[model samples]
Target chain A: MDDKDRELLRILEENSRLSVEEIGSMTNLIPAEIEARIHALEESKIIRKYTTVINWEKAGNAEVSAIIELKVSPERDFGYDRIAERLSRFKEVRTLRLITGTYDLQLMVSGKNMQDVSRFVSEHVAPMDRIRETATHIVMKSYKENGNTLFEQQEAERLPYSF
Target chain B: MRNFVSDRAREIPPSGIRKFFDLVMTMDDVISLGVGEPDFRTPWNICESGIYSIEQGVTSYTSNRGLQTLRDALSARLASQYQLKYSPDDEMIITTGVSEALDIAVRAIVNPGDEILIAEPSYVSYAPCVTLAGGTPVPVECTEEDHFRLNPDKLLEKITPKTRALIINFPNNPTGAVMKKEDLEPIADILSDKDLLLISDEVYSELTYESSHTAAATVKDLWERTITLNGFSKAYAMTGWRVGFLCAPKDICDAALKIHQYVMLCAPVMGQVGAVEALRSAEDEKTSMVNEYRLRRNMFVAGLNKIGLTCHVPEGAFYAFPSVRGTGLSDVDFAERLLKEQKVAVVPGSVFGRGGDYHLRCAYAVSRKDLSEALTRMETFISGL
Candidate 1:
């Protein structure tokens, strides 16, 4: 992507709700050009999905999240990819990664409650093929997520006017 | 009993921005575009450096000329950026802020009855600073017709036998006019023959969108007489830290230093530590902030034009000087009515000085949401007018 496209991405990443005309003004591009570039980026999957960062707890829909570490045997040619793809299809799996060190795979799993998450881990994740050991760490709190602070943002207490 | 306030202090008018500030304070949800400061906090790394210094008990006063390390970094930066050289030891002194630097620069250079020519529609403090230093501030008008860039002919017209110096700021406050190298060449040529010194306040140098800023001292024959003032306030978002640098020839530097050593002692050590870190590694953070400002300027200025407030595109600095003459109201009336009617705060341009009439100084240093909302309200207000 060009610098202008990158700039447009950065702006959208900060606030996806901005209109095309607003983006055009900010990027110094015409509406048509912005639309064309954004269309191209989306077609290439570079722009990805536009999503909102919501504090579910504030919305009265608190959920439980846990990091599950799995030790697994890599099957011949498929290695870890085959199992990773199978685990990715689960609705409870928010994110999955093939990690290094002691863990062969790490998954961020979320559910309606701690018991629900534990049930998912015990029933579905633990009995997976080629799995050796599974350990789940329940996240007690989230201070930051996806580059956004979960807590209150610092308010700059500036005077109403200054030189 | 004799009057307590001295005549110099008494004669200097209060800041024009102060009245609007008091008005804004009483109002609720006023989307203010009046303040000339960045909305961002100091970058995290820079703040961490200052905090680290304080945690390590480095809270004492730095050297009277500020930390040698900061001066060294500043010296190197000036050399690399503008090809201007100054000895860190004797030719540069850190001050509380550019406000203090400008104060001392005027105090050090002005003798009684000396006239200092200032470009009009400028910062509010320049004239009063000269007046308080017992000098005459002769305003050389820079009109909107010329996009507020200081003209050499107008500058020359204000020069007299009593003239001692010329004070200039660009990208200018209130107007956002920037002087490129070519624009400054003739002014440099004019001063090359005269005995006048140039006090260049380059606080907004890093905020230029169109081209890189050209330091006045870098011009031919101007380095010998130009006193450069800059600070971390605007670019680094460290206004509260109050670290500024003054660079000049040794003689003038020493003169300003003498006043600085007595009145201020030194800039805070913690802030100087942060400034060093800013110069060392905050380039990416600075560039990101400037880019954001450029974006905001484009959007806000275009929005103003679409709303029928005809604003000149500001090449540098965050302010948009939009004419309110189309509404058939004076600048002050326009500003007051806008604040009262629409709850959008902007400074009246006339407060800046001559040639500022019938214009409004709207700073684009706020968030895009607020800027958009303010524009909508302003459009409604204008349509109703």
Candidate 2:
């Protein structure tokens, strides 16, 4: 991507909430003009959905997060997309990315305890015929979450602007 | 064998502010100035009224136009504050916020491709709201050189055959500029003979510092065609309460109420009660808040100027728009780098409109304690830049 487009992406990757006017200021384009460029970016599939990132840990919810690996038996009739769709309907799955290694999907799930995790597997996941054999790894410590976020670490200080 | 999504949906990228806030949400010790909402609680009397409303079990919907008492309070307050008159029963409707008011007004009036005049840098909602309502948002860039007021000549020149409405927002967001009656006179005159309407946003009307606010509707020939928007959010620190108001002619209110009746049904019932309490009493609470903001604007402008940034001494609203030229970086770069380095957050200006080049808008609605510490950190950071 060119510098301007990359700059747009860099900013967007940082905050999808930035207004077209604000994005234009960053790139020296007028709001109406930037609106057009932003539209072009979306058309190119460079800019995706705008989602809020919540600090759930600080939101008075005491929970544990773990990334589980699953090897799903893809249905002959519906394929992997249907399997992924079915797996995604749960609220605990923070993310469920299909991958190409020892596991078919890398799942991020949060729970109150080990029993909660076990129940999620027993009731919701293992019961599904879109069959999946799973491996669980509780994150002992997150030096980093999602490449550059501070989501993994424990801290005592109160955060500004509560969720 | 494959279906495709249209290029139009694909072309528009999502908002950049959302992404940055997400990242900021992750990192540690991030002293955020990112959010634009006020730090103060909705005033106590207002909160009590809301509680009273809930306790009295007034949970069901009010009239589609809203609680009659709150509308009367709003009409009386508008008269007391800006000398504008409206028969609240006929002219006003309680809305979700000024944002929704803009929506219903535009939808009720403009046709597809109809041009709506807006001054920039302005609130982020204006253009997008206009576009969604199937009208063209023609931004007339108001400059800092002209004290951030819309140039009448530029505005007059931009008017076209398709121009159906003019949206005036003051004291404007981002820049915090308010237009005096003198500034509104010419535009009012021009519209006298035209087939057009005025959607005046006075959400920040209660916070003016230098001069008394003059509602455009108070200017003769303007009131007849004007749809005035004001809200409990800014003046009462009730952003989350979700109550605002709109005043226009009976015919237009009739059309807007239909769409609003289906879309919103009614504004939050307790919110309407809280708003009435806010409007009726604690006049000094409003005064005290404005006084504090006035002090903040003075201090902020002085500090920014002392640190080599140039900002207009704003007349109203609670933000300071400082030119970020001394740092030798673009406004966006300055904002990103400042946040990444110093851990202080401020919105870059262009987000308001094209009129906001080389500027950063700092909201002073945060606590003075936070503002003080933020300034100290900012000074050290800008010195290095």
Candidate 3:
């Protein structure tokens, strides 16, 4: 994409709710041009979705999260992709990846509480036929997530002067 | 109340750039290309020094010439970078930014009715500072055809028996015109023959793009007469620290320091501590900033030309002095209407002196996104015009 397109993507990534006119003034494009570009980006799926980053703890939805490393036995000729695809279908899995060193796959799963997460790991994950061993790491507290700090961002006051 | 003001204070007009800035300040969502300072924060190490000084209870005023270590660092930096020598102890006085240095330098040599020649379309403060010092500021016009280089022949014509000094800023503000070593040779040759002193403001010296800057003081015989003023403000993003230094022959420095001693006791201790750190650690940071500025300059200048506004590629500093004459608007009218209509703010060039009539000064020391956006708005605005 061109510089203008890249800039528009960055601005939208920061605040998706900004209006076409606002984006137009910021990017030097007219509102109609901004509208057309945004439309093209959306149609092409370059802009996947407009989503909010909510503070779940502040929203009173405290979740128990854990990263579960699994040793999986891949079927002949299918490799690890077949098992990875199957693991991604579970509602409990927030993210899944095939990792190197000791583990064939890693899954980040979340539930309402510790008991709920443990039950899912034992009943669903441990019983799977291809799953050989599982190691679960429960997250006690999250200081940072998704490139944002859990605490308030510090704003240092700048001293102003004429050069 | 009006009568209580000094005549010099009353006579000097309020800065034209400041007037425009005041208007722009009240308006929201204006993409400004008018700031003269770097957009970056002071480097962390430099800021840490200032913080450390505060924590260590180094809150008292520093020596009138600033910390010896800071002066020593500045001395070594000047020697190493520009090959110019100054004794830190007797030939340099740290002032409250380049503004103060310029002020005190003018006061040091200029007597009442003395003429100080300044190239047109330069920094806003030079003339007012001269005027405030009871000196007449003579405007020596430097045009776009000359790439805004001060013409030696033209400078000769402006010289009079009353002329005490010629003040110049290379990699100049408002215009961003820079002179190479060869380009400065002729000017140096001309000035060497003249009796007038040379006051060179090299604050933007580090922002040079294509080639390294040649300090006016470093030219063959001009060292004794040239008062070179520089600071960490532009180079290290330390504007608010109120730190700058003036280097000259011992006599002039002694005189300037006397004025500095009374007018302002000393530079801030924290700022002095920070300057020592900046001088020690900020070379790489300055180089990286200059590289970023170079990129922005290329993008903005090309963008301006592509959009039909003609801007000569500025070789130094962060400003692009683009001619808006093609659009048939006066610089003031162009700037005002652009701000009012397109939500973009820039300074009119006319305030810089005689040769600045139909141009606008666009500072590129802003974010790449903002520069791009501002250029787009300017294109649209000019097209509408």
DockQ of each: 0.72, 0.04, 0.09
Which stretches in model 1 have alpha-carbon errors above 4 Å? Answer: A72-79, A129-132
Query: Candidate 3, which CAPRI tier?
Result: incorrect
Could you report the Cα RMSD, in angstroms, for every candidate shown?
Answer: 1.9, 21.8, 7.4
lDDT of 2 by residue, B7-113 (tens): 43443345646655665777765566655556666678889989988999999999999999998887887888788888888889999988888889989998888
**Alpha-carbon shift of residue A5 in model 1 (angstroms):** 0.8
Name the docking class for model 2. Answer: incorrect
In model 1, pairs of residues that clash are: none
**TM-scores of chain B, in order:** 0.98, 0.95, 0.97
C-alpha positional error of residue B352 in candidate 2 after TM-score superposition, expressed in Å: 1.3
lDDT value, residue B81 of candidate 1:
82
Residue B16 displacement in candidate 3 (angstroms): 1.6
Model 1 C-alpha lDDT per residue in residues B1-385, reported as the tens digit of each score = 9999999999998777676777788889999898888999899999999888889989887889999999999999989987879999999999998999999999999999999999989999999999999999999999988899999989988889999999999999989999988889999998877878999999999999988999999887899989999999999998999999899999999999999999999998888999999999999999999999999999999999999999999999899999999999999999999998999999999999988999999989999889999999999999998
Task: List clash counts for every candidate, in order.
Answer: 0, 25, 0
Query: Candidate 1: lDDT of A10?
Result: 88
The local lDDT score (0 to 100) that residue B354 gets in candidate 2 is 71
Better of 2 and 3 by DockQ: 3
